[model samples]
Target chain A: MKFLGVIIVCLTGGLLLYGTTDFPDWGDPSSPASTHLSDYYIEKTIEDTKVPNIVTSVLADYRGFDTMFETAVIFTAGLACFILLRDFRGKKERFYRHKPTGVVLHVKDGKKTLTVGKEFEHMDKDWVPSDLIIKTVCRILIPFIQIYAMYVVAHGDFSPGGGFQGGVIFGSSLILLAISYDLKTLVNRIKEKVLGIFAALGVLIFVGIAAICMPMGGNFLDYTALAPLVWDPHHVRALGMLGVEIGVGFAVMAVMAIIYINIVSEGRHDEGL
Target chain B: MHWPIDLIVLTFVIFCAIAAISVKDLLGTAILFGAYSFMMCLLWAVMGAVDVAFTEASVGAGVSTVFFVAAVFRTSRRTKD
Candidate 1:
């Protein structure tokens, strides 16, 4: 059976390779894809949206519906992960450590809870003492990483990065905190409820901005309709794209954190890597 | 000039893909998958898709690798097949 599967895979691969032979060369000027709308986008993106980055304008403005749905899809993914993996039931066992003495305590009873003061710190079941250097370095570096992420999101109009990339970077910074410190640090710092709210709020922001256009005498996601609201009407479309990018950034960041937390903790929301 | 770099990156990508699948340790597989993603990101950059390259680098190489590691940390390290 394995041999048959391998043979089938080989045949499929071969067929795919053969099919690629008829494809246009890379960056062919007259290719169907390039010839269709690429010229118009390249030529008029700046004039239309006032965003220097053609990709940003095209993604957040010209093709607004696609991106709106894409954000919704990411939100749905987080929602699904929450529904499938989130475990509300309390765990029977818990562990805590005396911060000064380095003594560990195990509590078998589920109902009894500790006061959790500065003297005692939560510990994972398979916990090891996190290295001081790593923690210190991450502590110092996380802010810069976060700032860079914000820069990427804010400067999407002029740069290569946009919301998705920036959001992922920001989310990874949070995950780095979890890995360096512990899952509890992350969960305690940013509550699960807050994460869920941010995820929904991000999608809402995108939809709200788009929907607002309808009542303002323009089509959905039409930035021109929002001209009256902003101080600089000439760059209203750029501002709209910026708002949309921020929404996507929020959604992606929250979803990344959500998925990471859920998977690491196995939905217990207590102890994890 | 660009074709050589693209070809080299593509070759590395294919190697990484095959190695990731064939590796017995799931942790190793995750790392290899990250290598594959980085190579693909490089290829995208070479092809003049800076935006795509940025997405690939962050989502594929940066975060996804960490996700894979978290998953492996929770689950078994070795694969059955």
Candidate 2:
């Protein structure tokens, strides 16, 4: 099997290297990739969409439907991870420890075998002591990271970031909190149900905007149709782009969190590494 | 390709990619893969595709590295490879 893999890799690499010879030189002005659609987009993006960032206008406005479906793809991935990993079967035996005299009690079923006591710790054998430095630093820095993520998402029209990048950044902050403190701490703050809703809601917002355009007289995802109710046609396209970006941001953020939580917990959210 | 810095980054990227696959420790492999991603990010930045570079830095070097570490944490660290 390994030999076959190596042979396949060698063949693929040889083909790719051969293919690269036909590609235009780096930064060639007359390259097909640079000449064909690039010229049109570079020249017309500002005039048509009123957005300075060509990538953003192209991704969110010119190809709004594609972005909407891309957001849906992320949403679907989150749903798939949730479905594949989530375990509904009964949990294993749990042990409870009394705090007063250091006594351990094991419970097999959910028959309320032990009476509730305020002085009892749940005997979290898997729990680890969070690092003081890590917890303190993450607590201080998470807000700033989140603010920067929001900034990236909002300023994507003029910057080098957009929904997908900003969303990943935002999701990373939550994951950082999880790593610094614990899975329980992060889960307590943001419930799985909320993440699921956000995932679906994000895609819904994207499709909803596009579908609204259809009813307003223009084709699907046509932002010009929105001008009658809001702003100039050019500005409407920019606004539509912003709305699409926000939808993509929400979808990507939820999906990243969902995938992380599911993978960490092995589909059972009872405890995580 | 810009010769000096780009070549340096490309060399480091290849080294890291090879090292990542060769490492016996799964955790070490994951970290090396993250380094490879950072190098790729630098290559894209040098190529002037700032949007692609930004996405690679955030996704490849940032979130992907975190995911790799988390996966490594959940799984066994030792590997036959």
Candidate 3:
């Protein structure tokens, strides 16, 4: 199987290298990619959408339907991971270890509840002691990381980052918390059901904004038609773009967290690696 | 052509890619792959695609690496290769 994989990869690389021979010189302004709608997007994005970042303006405004679908794709990934993983059936037996005496006790049938005292603590079968340095540093840094993620999402119009990047960063922060502390710490902070709702809400927001434009008597994602509702016709596209980015951010964040949690837990949230 | 920096980074990228695949330890491979991603991100930044570079830095070097590490943690560390 590995040999076959190597052969396939080599073939694909060869094919790609052969295809690259017909490509224009690097950074050529006359290249098809730069000569096509990219030129128009560069020249007119600021004026058309009142957005300084041409990429965001083009992605969320000019080609909004595609962005909406992209958001849906992220949401679908989160949903798929949730469906594939997330075993809710409680474990038949729960185990506790006495820290002081080094004695292990197993509770059968979830009938008896063990009091989590200073000496007694609930433990997974294969549990590693948390690292002090990692836990401490991450505890201090996660909030700042999350704030930066939000800033990236909000300032996509003026910055290089957009919803997708920002959302991934945000989701990564949650994953970091899980890594530093444990999956229980993460699950306690943000429930699985809440993440599911967030994933769906993001796609709904994108679709809702596009659907709103339809009733306004314009095309599906026409922000110009939103002129009557908002104060300025020129700035409405920028606002619409921001809204779409926020939706994308939410979906991507939820999906990334979902994938991480499921994969780490191996479909059983009872314990995480 | 300002080839020095680009060539150096590209060389490192290829080296890391090969090293990652050749490594027997899956966790080590993941870290090397992350280094390769960082190099790719730098190349993109040099090409003036700040947005693509940013995405690669955050997603490729950051989240994907974490995911890879988490996956390795769940499974065995040793590989036949």
Using DockQ, give the best candidate's number.
1
List runs of model 3 lying over 4 Å from the truth: A1-9, A97-104, A108-121, A231-233
Candidate 1: segments with Cα more than 4 A from true spot? none
Among the numbered candidates, top TM-score falls to: 1
| TM-score leaderboard ranking | 1, 3, 2
lDDT of 1: 0.94
Worst 10 residues of 2 chain A by lDDT: A121-130
Residues A10-111 of candidate 2 have per-residue lDDT tens digits of 999999999999998988999987989889999998888889999888888877777777887788888998999888664566657787777877787755
Per-candidate TM-score against the hidden true structure = 0.98, 0.91, 0.92
- DockQ, every prediction: 0.91, 0.77, 0.84
Residue lDDT tens for model 1, A1-273: 999999999999999999999999988999998998899999998788888999999999999999999999999999999999999999998898998999999999989878899898778899888999999999999999999999999999999999899999999999999989999899999999999999999999999999999999999999899999999999999999999999999999999999999999999999898
Model 3 residue pairs with clashes: none
lDDT (Cα atoms) of all candidates against the true structure? 0.94, 0.84, 0.88
Docking class of 3: high
TM-score for model 3?
Answer: 0.92
| Between candidates 1 and 2, the lDDT winner | 1
> Taking the tens digit of each residue's C-alpha lDDT, what string does model 3 give over B1-81?
767999999999999999998999999999999999999999999899999999999999998898898889888998965
